[model samples]
Target: MNGSLRTILAASIAAMAMTGVARAADVPIVPYVEPVPVGGWYLRGYIGMSNQQLGKLDNVLFTPGTVEFLDSGGFDAAPIYGIGVGYEFNEWFRADLTGEYRGKASFTALDRYDFNGDNIWDGSNDYSANKYEWLLMANAYVDLGTWWGITPYVGGGIGASRNTISNFQDINTPNGGVAYAPSASKWNFAWALHAGAGWEVTQNVTVDLGYRYVDLGDGETGDIVGYNGLNTVNNPMIFDSLTSHDVHLGVRYAFQ
Candidate 1:
């Protein structure tokens, strides 16, 4: 080949290489993006303080002309703890299964002097007991729209409870006082009404502060001895109602 022909081929090759480089430089680079989480199922834990009420204490002796009457009854506040699993079915509705433990509460009562039938109502038969409950519930809630990442909610639940009454005693106040009604466990229907707000800490985490009005039906004691030794062992006292107003703080973690 001649020098003219060789030079012309070299020039064409050089132009093609430079054109390829220019095309590469014209392409744009894309920045990488990280993934974000969303909600589905969740797990929760909670703790609370309970202001409990023990309704009237009923004695079998209060029936007919039995000579026993309830003068007064009261209860002390207690604590509670729970755990649950739930599903979020969109941004407005959710459901959960929860198990809870209510700490023991103390009770007190007085049986007045109806035994004398004088209608003066004078003597003191003192009563005391400790109660606790194991509760299981299925609940549903309506989550109002999120505003500033805070969601207000209302809900309800129906369930069962194992209520226990322990360390119960009835002091005669006359026979130098005595103990009656041993420990006993009973199962009952339970229900709750709830209102609360949830604060979104992140896409997958939340904090809840709430209030609940719960009803635990009733509880009772074991056999009663009446005194140190008596046929009163045939009787057991009943706590007519067990109810509470509760304030709780909780945390929820959602699975994305």
Candidate 2:
């Protein structure tokens, strides 16, 4: 019985030694772990051209008892700039707060009229105006990860704009002598919508291109002329509306 037990113990020790050697040979030399990117804060800036227009303003107020005039058509491309702050919620989504400023845009018009068909009453008229707008917005975006070192994203936002308008007109004699005076000033309030895509240049910097549309409320008008140029003019009325289109490019930074 003792000799049989000794033989079994020897066989078990030999089997365990061979299994350890085989396992070591099968083990790989290198080790690896799946990757995960860290997330935190980010910022960006952009500039682009804007296609701006003011809707038709018809029969705008003028001198009392005098015929109303239509505001001339105006359009232009202006520079636009923006900045933003963002919080990355995950690998694919982020929320941001942004602000943009658009440079001054201006337009003008001129008209000639025959007052009572009298040569002495004939006069030439003019209209001139300018506007400046600023917006504050909030938006959410989806990051499509990276492809060929370029990261593309799309998003939208709602915001408000402060607008100013300056309207002026001049009346002159047939001989070019000044007959009526020039009128000009500023007005404000508009709302806006924005959307765009951006390219990530690095983990910390980004470049963006986008577009926005703004709707400025109607215009407010008051009497411009008086009888004998002394008494106040009644029948004051407000006319006109303002709107604009904007294209922009910007850069941003991310903080981990």
Candidate 3:
């Protein structure tokens, strides 16, 4: 072959080989994404702590011609458990239906009454009273995503509650001291409002903390009269309205 032709052919072959190598390098061998399932229905179970307080009431009992007294401090703390069904609307928002059970919480109070206008005291005056309550609820929520690993949310619901009063003891009084014993249980309609946030510890598991305020309607406390071997006096009374402020910490699992 002529020198000039040989040199041109050799240079052409070298360039073609270089181009093949460059094309192969530009083609990616692995994709750059992860697979995640986004929307679905999920069920969550939770348990946490709660604190409750009861509101004040007047003329608790309609005891004619006498004054009634109730202990103002009816606050308690206990464990709470619940289950919920939820729907994920997107990455930022979701809604849920929840119901919770709170164990029995109780407190004691004293009730006293004046029977007659007699200057000489003679009546059964003192009695001991006990109170307790339970709650059920449902709510909706908004997930605020995450900062480090924490997610925040808010929700509300309506439910029913039961209040009970028992264990009455008669107190000594002048006017031949009257013996009075009273106990009753009542169910009432109620509602709850709550706001809280949680932390995702893993892809499918979360730890949540929150606060809720609830209102349980008023109940009736019947007239008090003598029971067993005690003097009798009938005075009407009503149970006051109830409320609670609860702080809770719990765990949740998401099916992804």
Winning model by TM-score? 1
Q: In model 2, state the lDDT of residue 51.
A: 78
Q: By lDDT, who's the top model here?
A: 1
Residues 1-256 of candidate 3: C-alpha lDDT, one tens digit per residue: 9999999999999999999999999998997788766656767777766576656534434355564544554545667777787777776777677767765555544444565645333333444445555666666677767799887888777877776655544455444444444567778898888789888788777787888888877654556565555324455445577777777777767778
What C-alpha lDDT do the candidate models reach, one value each?
0.86, 0.61, 0.66
What's each prediction's TM-score?
A: 0.81, 0.68, 0.70
Q: Per-candidate RMSD vs. true structure? A: 6.6, 5.2, 5.0
**Clash number for every model?**
1, 9, 19
Q: Over the full model, what C-alpha lDDT does candidate 1 score relative to the true structure?
A: 0.86
Better of 2 and 3 by TM-score: 3
Between prediction 1 and prediction 2, the one with superior TM-score is: 1
- The residue ranges of model 2 lying beyond 4 angstroms of the native Cα positions read 1-17, 24-39, 58-71, 110-125, 144-146, 170-192, 216-241
Please give, for residues 1-256, the per-residue lDDT of candidate 2 as tens digits.
Answer: 6999999999999999999999999998887886646578887777777777656545433434343344465745667777778888887788888777777666665555555645443555564555556666777777777776566666555655555444433444354543222232334455566666567677667676667676655543334443235423343223356766777777767785
Residue 87 lDDT (model 2): 86
Give the alpha carbon lDDT tens digit for every residue of 54-87 in model 1: 7778767664543455656777888899999999
